[model samples]
Target: MNKKKIIANIVKVISWIFVLVFFYWAIKNNMLSHIYEEPDKFLRLLKQHVTIVFVSGLAAIFTAIPLGILLTRPKFRKGEWLFVNIANLGQTIPSLAILALAMGFLGIGIKAAIIALYVFSVLPILQNTIAGLDSVDKQTIDAARGMGFTPVQILWKIEMPQASFFIFAGIRTALVINIGTAALAYLIGGGGLGVWVFTGIQLFDNSFLLSGAIPITILAIAIDYLCRGLEYLVVPKGLRLARKTNG
Candidate 1:
């Protein structure tokens, strides 16, 4: 099997192990009892959590990718360093701190929490997009130019295809981190599965904690897997094979 396949299999095995452990722990401690008893409450928080992550993640993707593309262009190259450093600075700030800062400006709400998450997520996707496009072989681009391919054609057909994997990798990493960070949004009254998590903490109820926490873990993993599927469908077959061989 290829390196990619080997790595994927290993990840799958590891994910399953964690899932089984979560279930075993849940059963042993009755951590999921509250979820069964309060199905509506659990589902409501689940929906809220999903909404927060989805909105922020989507915003990050939309904003960062285009900005990354612009920064990579010859006209914008001079300003790239400044913008990149700014994005990197977002990563330096603690997640909770960012949320709190947003709260200070916007007041306590889902909107503030989402803005913070978007800020946090932008760096990875931006960095990856820039890196991906940069890593595309210069010779290949030049060859395309020599072949009379328009700048737009070269960008869409050649550059984007080569860069897509890295872009997706960034998105997956960002969204997973976002999921974990989102749990902290509860502290700011942003409301999510974090509500249950903090409720457990305050009340010392393990059931509430596990019920809220494990689903977040599962959601992050599911998102990572979904992005992988997108990579398979959106990235070209030739690119996939080439990356596997090179990887």
Candidate 2:
């Protein structure tokens, strides 16, 4: 009923319309001819790509969130800058270079790709978790302490809940980045949609290129929307209402 809601609805409608149109164009032009010719291969590659993204994302989340929390604690605060800079270095390097390094040390396969993706995907989640925890209201923390809540209790009950939205935002970003970067896995003999893309380029076939490219684009967009919905669902209702009102 509100202006923002109306605009969001309109944007959603247009996005679906665009996807539908693109799909129709691809089908009409036989852009997926290569995919249809070997459905099994396409399916296998799709599964591999999704698996890499999912596994690497989980790795990043588990590693980064705990490290971020630890860095915020008094005993670990001094090392925060060191860890943050190391994470930042991961992002600063080219993804292809990371994959190459993985290939050099870990060999050419899923193991190497997973290691590279995990490293590349970690920084955003780590940074966001730290920022989210840091942004929690000091007054709220003080009040919790006054109520005799233990440090752990305050973190679990107050800090994490307040920071959940920001944390999820970071995750969403990491997911999108992972989806895009996972394409490079094919270069290291880690099967993914990149196989089709590179093959298309090597063969000079537009159909092969679109076959891979379109699906990656769709997957990223779909996951992005899914994460956006999850963010709304998981964030406290009061916080959601406040955000809407403030916006």
Candidate 3:
């Protein structure tokens, strides 16, 4: 059909082909045999990894979104810069260092890992929410106010809908980051796929390393694609149409 659609189809085909090739290589080389041998243990580690990522991401979303919104309000506007810097500090610090500090205060366990992951993952969502809300058209907001809409009603009905795209983009970024970082949770005695990876490192076993790494890479990519689909669903239809037309 059209050039853009044709290019998109080609890209999609190539992506699937690549995935199939990678899996075939893994199987042919027996890179995943270790995983297959202990299917239950592998599954349990996968579950733990998924749980850590999901819980940390959920916590970040709940805290950051509301705080981001509050920062945009008149009462908190003056402190926006302060809070943004604090969030930035979290990103600037190494995740390992964060975990170490957390261990001292919160002890070494899943709790520390979750706290560290949550801290590390907050900035993207927080910044994006603020940016999205701030970017809403002034004219639209004024129009809403003129229609006798309360501030809360205007925000809920108008601003938030417009900002959903940026917010979701932030969330997608945070989730991907959290997934990668969760691999380090095993360092804190938090069980996950990282257990296999670290054990491989200790024993100098390539297969064990691949067993953990391959699944993590796959999970991250899958979750990213899932979030992309979610972005389409959550972002308003009108906004999507407008974006397409503008592009």
Off by over 4 Å in 2: 1-17
Give the lDDT of residue 129 in candidate 1.
98
Q: Rate the local accuracy (lDDT) of all candidates.
A: 0.91, 0.92, 0.92
Expressed as tens digits, the lDDT of each residue in 1-247 for candidate 2 is 7888899999989998988998999999999997889899999999999999999999999999999999999899999999999999779999999999999999999889889999998999999999999999999999999999999999999998888888999999999999989999999999899999888999999999999988898899899999999998888899889877887
All-Cα superposition RMSD per candidate = 2.0, 2.0, 2.1
Model 1 pairs in collision: none
| All candidates in order of TM-score, best leading | 1, 2, 3
Worst 10 residues of 3 by lDDT: 238-247
User: Which sections of candidate 1 miss by over 4 Å?
Assistant: 1-15
- Scored against the true structure, residue 136 in model 3 reaches a CA lDDT of 97
Give the per-residue lDDT digits (tens) of candidate 3, residues 46-98.
Answer: 99899989999999999999999999998999999999999997899999999
Q: What TM-score would each prediction reach against the true structure?
A: 0.93, 0.92, 0.92
